[model samples]
Target: MRENRLWSFLYKLQDKQQKWLWLRSCYFGLKTTGPLLLLGILLQGLTLSFFQPHGFFYVIYRLDRQVWVPQANFIIHSLSCIVFGMTLLLLCTAVAWYRARLFSKKETIPSMVIALFLLFLFNFHTKRMPSARLGQVILNGNIPFIEVLFLGLVSAYFYHGLNKFLHFKSLWSIAGATVSLGIVLRGFKHLFNVGFFASLSGPLFAEISSLLGDDQTQLGTIIVREVGRNLLVWLGFVSPEQILVAHTDSDLSRANLSAALIKNNLEGLPHPLNIYSLSDSFAVLGGYGQIMALLLLFILFSRYRKRRRNAWQNFLPVFLNLNSSFLVGVPVFFNVILLIPFLIVPTVSILLAAGAIKLNLIPPAVYQVPLNTPTILNAFMGTNGNWDALLFTLIVLLVSMLLYYPFFKVTETTLYRIQKGTE
Candidate 1:
């Protein structure tokens, strides 16, 4: 049976066209089904967050929740998945090909080295959180980290396959490699004793400082999500009316959107709101102008050592969803050139989502999803399992990537000029 199954897999790969289709299918499937599975998981989370607040089990369980469950919500998930997923797939394919092509390489080793060695050297020993709370400090016995272990293993394999273009025949080798990673990660310790390296912002700031001059530049101002947050608030999405009243055609429109009459005022408790669009969550794909995307772009695609080194140095912070380093580092704060898209992208994202909400095309994101949650998950959780919001967030992210592309290229040019003593 094993031999027969193996032969079938081999045969599928033997046909080049079939192989491409399979790969594309998997990518699309992930772009599509991954969210549906996450949506169902989100549904379960919505169910649980109400009952259990302080348990570690709920956290890990939801973190580890697979999308394979049989659930009634799958239908809802599937519909949104197909609609948004295909759209996202197209957008991503286009950007990656023309705009973001050769823009990023997921180099784990060099990045880790620069990030650890450099950030530690730069942080000045500013502690951010308790060792136990900071993670990486305590690698074992933290049940919440089970999610990390599995996620890391999966990511390691997925990226490995992508980077190496492994074939079906390499499945066993891949499995063996994954096991090896698990073993390695389990034994690894935070030997640098560098809490600040892990916690504090570093190298990206140097990159920004280099290009945009220094703190003396009036342009040294940083991006503060000034675009997305204020717009959503002005549009009444952030601050929804207490009661939603039905009215004439004009009033029934998306512009007249309102939230649930009751909000979770239980001191620290969070509840659903109907009026909040995904403005804040979708504002930045990976922080201001989705600059983390820019970091990855530079790291993988940049021809300059300055950019590549700084990008890798900041990659850890960016991946951790800490982007101020990149922002202040890039000095996107004051670079009028970069700042244009920095502000405009979020504004567009906010308006796009607000218009959608006004039209009742998608739901508002009222759930206070965990803060600093990355990308699509933010869309999912912030909307309280609303797939439309997740899809919309992705669309916003895609557009944001495009918006950032030209500016990124310009930044690269400026850096090149600086290198050549032309600027």
Candidate 2:
């Protein structure tokens, strides 16, 4: 009952004119850049799966390394930069155009150009050559979603606000004001990065880890970290792996693997509740927040054709555990409505998996798996082809479906109203 009320209150709050306008603008901005972001996600995944170390093209497919590696490297890096650059450019352009249309219709073109100029200015660094800026958007594991979203929104917001507040009639004056805003904001960003975030994040993480203790095998600790990572991702930050690195990489994961290798069985390895055993194998099906369940919900039941179509478009990528498309398109990022299930579904799934492991219904997923493996089979692969593990994975997914269905309905209804421009 309380959960329903919270969602109801959130929906009511979002229906207000100001909030709705912001949401509509964000949605529009996403429409402008969603395709490129999706492409970036797909390409990044493909590059990792086919070209990176232990990639299928090398490890599984046994491609000729000498011939393909160099070309693969060039193609992957170049395409990633190009796609990200295009997406970032489109995001700033779309936001500037939309915000300027709302603020001062006559100056929309200037606003857009200034927005692009600001993008170049923000990315420029005095110490590095121009091409080095491309490195910033290389679409590696650490995609700068937060930075891109922040800069695009802030640049456009400042442009609109300055034009509305100061009535800058001249494009030169507008440009100057924007330059000033960018300089000031960029300085603050640098300070936060070098000084504030540097000072706070490390110690803060250490403190949390200490509190969580060295024994990450505890299911409660795993649950907290899993939920925390999802929350961070929803807020558009990179999910910090320090909290819970993949089971394949962590110390506990190593110990578990070594033990399993020594025993030649899956009876009682250490760290059964580590991320690989639970979160990666079960909770994060279809990337963070079990988005596969939501996509399935959309494909099976959503009344909106666009939503259903989008579900299909993103399915293949999400199936391979690349979910930036839906994250940007439906924009689960910073979406409070979906945030509920985004956190809840994963938390519940982890708990269910942990319970199954505890009861010995299935062994913990201690084995290492390949990159870009189908998420449903992660547990099966990790458990050395354990059919019970596969069944458990499917059960968790069905539970996610049940948990996500109601929220999906709410999201579609609200989006329908937004799309129809109906208050």
Candidate 3:
């Protein structure tokens, strides 16, 4: 029974992998889809400009007029509905191509382009007519639904036909198709003012604010969600939250500190003081500094290994955090137990900083700082000239380095053992 269950699980996993691959292929095929979609958006923009008197100028105009602009609202709403419907049609077509086995078998760029143009024309004409008149002028019944359905069918047929014609047998061709589809969708979005993307912004910001609450939590959430999630996903980890804390207590403490500071200085504080600017310091450190450091380290290590080719036999694996690869491929993990210390060092330093702030040994961060500021600058700005943050960050860095030393030693030992075994 256990054996049967194991087989079933493996089969399910295999099925999911296959589906993911197919979707990825469609995402890649966009050299043609990109231009066509852009053209569609441009045309829509032109149409809006021509029909509306205020035109593109009104979009950015902030001045409020006392008079009602009925024509402007009518034009915007009608155009938005049509553009939205057309975008949906294109997206559905891409999804169909992604799922279709035939997508791997053909090249139908010409047909796909032609079909897209026709659909655009149909949508434009339909949108020009009054909404109430749609039912009266239908080929079958309900003109709007019929037009959408017909366009969808045509798009699917073209996609399938293109797959057969192009003979997209390779992985690259599938990738091209997916990219093309994405470009087309983006173009359509540009044409419509209806706010498909805008709709997402409010909800996304709300959710982010809810999760992060304050500046520090927001910063941590951004790192974990944006950076950690991307890294873990690349490493084949399914759930990012399992590896990183989605929310840190440090954020709440920081917010509380801000409130206390505001209360203490209520009478004398600058009226227009900006607290969020301090965040830029940590942003620059984590974003640019960390990336540059990692890249430089990798490049230096790679160059050094090139001089002694055998060095790569162990160095490459540990450098990638794939110690198991060095251990099994080169057999280094167990022998390189020192590497364990290096791994713990950075985490420990961060935890200590967090602990000190929590215990009030160090000040809780109060200002809302920008993410682009250098570490020392962030501390200075957040504390309004205080040097404690600068010192704290430097201490953390030193601790991290100390932690890494033991790990490097373990790595060296593993490399030596692997080399000896090979000899």
Taking the tens digit of each residue's C-alpha lDDT, what string does model 2 give over 105-222?
A: 7657776777776666667655467655544423233435566555666656776676678777777887688788878877886887577766667888677876455447777787
What's the lDDT for residue 234 in model 2?
Answer: 86
Any idea what lDDT model 3 has?
0.38
| Per-candidate local distance difference test | 0.41, 0.75, 0.38
Cand. 2 Cα-lDDT: 0.75
In the range 227-332, model 3's lDDT, one tens digit per residue, is: 4323332232321001111111344534544564768532222211111222222222222112212222323443335323433433422222212112122111
Choose the strongest candidate by TM-score.
2
Model 1 misplacement above 4 A: 1-225, 228-276
| CA deviation > 4 Å runs, candidate 3 | 1-161, 165-209, 215-284, 288-293, 304-350, 359-361, 367-371, 395-423
What clash count goes with each model?
7, 0, 42
Candidates sorted by TM-score, descending order? Answer: 2, 1, 3
